[model samples]
Target: MPGCCLWGSAPPAPSGERKGAGWLELLLLLLLILSGWVLTQQPVGCPRVCECFVEEKTVKCANQNLTEVPPDLPRDVQNLFLTGNRLRDLSSGAFPSEPLLELRNLSLRGNQLEQVGAEAFARLPNLKQLDLSQSALLWVSPMAFGNASSPLEELRLSNSLYNYSVVAAIAELLQRGIFQNLKHLDLSSNGLVSLPPGIFSRLPSLQHLDLHNNSLVSLRDVSFGALHQLQRFDLGDNALKRLRNDTLAQLRGLPWLTRLDLGRNAWVCDCGIEDLARWLKESDQVEAKEALKCSEPEEKQNSSLVSLPISGLECLEPDDDQTQLQTSYVFLGIVLALIGAIFLLVLYLNRKGIKKWMYNIRDACRDHMEGYHYRYEINADPRLTHLSSNSDV
Candidate 1:
């Protein structure tokens, strides 16, 4: 009878029924299917246009005609090669800054970049090397790279279309020590006429400096005061006439300096150049000593600066004794000329009196001659006087 009652109870509903479990399973199955579909729709890492080496963490996007940074770059990219791109300007957030935190090397060379925003590289904390060369850059904001979290080691802004305005802003940045950790800096081929005083004072760690192919007129003694660790200095192909002895002294302050390129410049080879010549000969710092030439003093023209003796290079001082003597002679001659002119003027003004005095002298001389003649005639009349005495007797 008990078995009969259990059968009527529908076998206890087969014992394992949980009412909500089917719906829960169905929901989980739908969620998993949805996740799989999403995963399949997403492409693999790296943008379609870029070739990324995930293992090496390097991205080669060079010459990609990329107008803007791709949005789908891997987050682990360290070296980014965006050279020869059509990137006009580096505005803030142009590239996803968060994804580029690990980026170390950035190459923007050959790009048509004219301006760079201040917050352009603010998000790249580990960035060390940057190449903005050949960018046709006309202006750079003074606040560019301001408060940068990166320790930029190498910077190349050379061959950019930097006029005085851009160069001045750059000088201001250098003077303020914006890139203090920079070791190698290339500012060559910039149309720089002159550098601001104490421009390199803040770059204490700078080891190599390139100022070649510029229109630099001079370098001051205090210009490299803070570059105590400088090893190489390139002033070749510049418009430099001469370097001051004091400036040479400042260059000497760098004990580690090994290579100096002073060739292809307009060297005067005068007294002011003696110190540099001596340095070129004696010091082992000059790298291209043989290539150095003098452009001035027709005699020293094209002569090798290194071989020229220091004694041969003598500058004529503007205030030297010889100059002073010449000046004094000129002054004396002028004074004599003035005196002679005054005398002539006086003679001309008193022409009538002078003429009357000359006439009076002529008359007096004539009267004296006539008197002499009359005396001679009287002496000759002595015989007549004797005849007259006889008649009186």
Candidate 2:
């Protein structure tokens, strides 16, 4: 009976055991409180000027008037925005003192960056996207990035690269096989007059190229020859008067091309632009098809390029120089024909004399051969020589 407990009836425990149980429960509660506090606290290592989101792993220092990159930043940040700053130069080790191994995207747009030093982004090994648009970037070292086989896929240099020299430098860098994994590139509003040949040859994976709002008068066929994966190309708002058939053929050769922008250009509706106008009519890839209008030749100033028929785009009457050249060619050809006819007529009129002269030459050759033959026989035999001499006497 003493060892057995009845229903809803139990024996009391010792005070020491009770106290031990209470202490254990208190310890568990304290531990939970501490863990909750740790979870709620803000992440450390955030720079004073930056707003860092711990959960998203993003750091935004945009429009902060920062002269340099913040020295203290979370080591695991993936996206960093440093736009609208006064960062004039980006030297090597441009990031924080310690490398951000997890960084994937970096933006330096709207900065006053004049130069980018060698291996400036060497620390960010996993970087995939970079934005340097709206900056005054005058120079970028060929080795600004450490790896030629970098994983960077998107690069924006719009509104930068003011002169041909800067563009040439960038072209040289691309030709060196840097950023081989690049996909999207923005070079719009760069005041480019012409792109260097084979400029995009090394970028085999490029899918989107934006070159709108430039001063490009013409494009070489080889400029986009290697962009087999290109899907979108923007050549709008340029100073182009006409596109050559070879250039249009090159555009058509892009297997993946889906969107093309050629509007807002100074198109001239003439024989020189027949190829482009015909291409516009036949192809549906051109964006803003209705806005492409002719700007020259008072009669076609406001005409749409897409609506103009190939027959309507006629060559103007031959200029004086062209007429003169054509006349000279015709005269030369006639003179040659007349000379040939005269020569034939002269040969016919002198046929008899020519035949007699030919017979005289043949007889002289025959007699001379016979004399040589007789001399050889006389030399070979002494009897023959004496006999011939006696006969002669």
Candidate 3:
């Protein structure tokens, strides 16, 4: 229709017709309608000073440079990550009357909190993990952990608190068996001494314990006496002077001991460390069989306490007591062997005595036969005659 100017072409239908575009348009329009309905359904006003933004059911306004506690959260937020915030000093009643916090999987890590209020986390019955690490905490209130005996599976307090009070708090937890189901605990890089008594002992189900870079001097007896199911133990970079035999004696017997890292403790080279060295000799894991010598003070550092490998680390001479111990063991083995040899000698002597008796009986029988039937009764060959016998005629 070159000259007829046909008005029927419909401008080529505006090209780029999307497949199923009508259904997609309908779905988007329906979603918009639903969103409008939801907005209208909200009964109350929006919270002030809290950037309230919701997505389906979650409302997150974390990292708002909050000074006190982050309060007035949504009522149904199941997962809340309050990281990279300025919240400090979570006092009591910080999260009061907040319904969503009760069911939230909260993380308050990397905050500026100096002290955690007592019974702060007493609520939140459904909380699974509470991360308080990297908060630069100076103190921890008693009962700061979960209540009702159902603590979070992973409680991270690394770089959160330290010193005597932290130890005291952990000890208190141990005494009461508060962390019965705690799977992992991170107390690394803290100023801790030996494991506070009753703390590690109470955590029966603990699988991992991170206590690296602590100021642990010695693991005395009863230090790690309880961790029955511990798979990983990190005690690196600590100022450890000794790894006592009794302290780790129970751990050595654990059947599930797979990884033991005692790399940087600088266990002073001495007879005190011999027990571990000897155990490593018969071990299939852990490479501590060599003398664990001191690695500082270049002059006297290379020396070891004694030779556990029978030819290394001969710094200390075998003392009197050591010699006595060796002597006792050697004497015992030698005595047993000597007793066995003596018993065999006695048996041989008994057999020889029986043989001589039979020979004497046979000779007597022959002498009787000769005397009765043949010639002289007691006659004997010249070679067999005794000098003391009467001269034969």
Model number with the top TM-score:
2
> Which pairs clash in the backbone of model 3?
none
Candidate 3 runs further than 4 Å off: 1-63, 98-104, 145-147, 284-393
lDDT of each: 0.79, 0.85, 0.64
User: Clashing pairs in model 2?
Assistant: none
TM-score for candidate 2, residues paired by index: 0.69
The per-residue C-alpha lDDT of model 2 at residue 264 equals 89
**Candidate 2 stretches greater than 4 Å from native:** 1-41, 316-393
Show how many residue pairs clash in every candidate, following the order shown: 0, 0, 0
Model 2, position 234: C-alpha lDDT score: 91
Candidate 1: Cα lDDT at 199: 70
TM-score of each: 0.67, 0.69, 0.60
Clashes of 2: 0
- State the lDDT of candidate 2 residue by residue for 156-218, as single tens digits: 999989678889888877888876789999999999887888789899999999999998877
Better of 1 and 2 by lDDT: 2
Clashing pairs in 1: none
**CA RMSD per model (angstroms):** 28.4, 24.2, 30.2
